[model samples]
Target: MPARVVVGVVTSDKASKTRRVELNRTVQHAKYGKFV
Candidate 1:
């Protein structure tokens, strides 16, 4: 018989509310100018 195990990092580096808002807004604005 054999056993297998798996692990991974399920977390976010940005956890601050204000910073998260700023980061998301910046990304959204940048993507808005990109032509897809």
Candidate 2:
């Protein structure tokens, strides 16, 4: 298999044991516009 491109955001880093990651995504709307 081939490697794919991925994007993510770090929401929290205060924890010493683990990290919190928030996946990024794009969405299109007719009136509301684009959202992350």
Index of the highest-TM-score prediction:
2
Could you give candidate 2's per-residue lDDT for residues 1-36 as a string of tens digits? 659777788899898988888986777876879664
Model 2 local distance difference test score: 0.80
Name the regions of candidate 1 deviating beyond 4 angstroms. Answer: 12-36
Compute each candidate's TM-score over C-alphas: 0.20, 0.44
Tens-place lDDT digits, model 1, residues 3-22: 94444453455665523221
Residue pairs in steric clash, candidate 1? none
**Range of the 10 consecutive residues with the lowest summed lDDT in candidate 2:** 27-36
Candidate 2 local lDDT, residue 11: 90
Task: Give the Cα lDDT of each candidate.
Answer: 0.41, 0.80
TM-score of 2: 0.44
- Model 2, backbone clash pairs (residues 3+ apart or across chains), number: 0
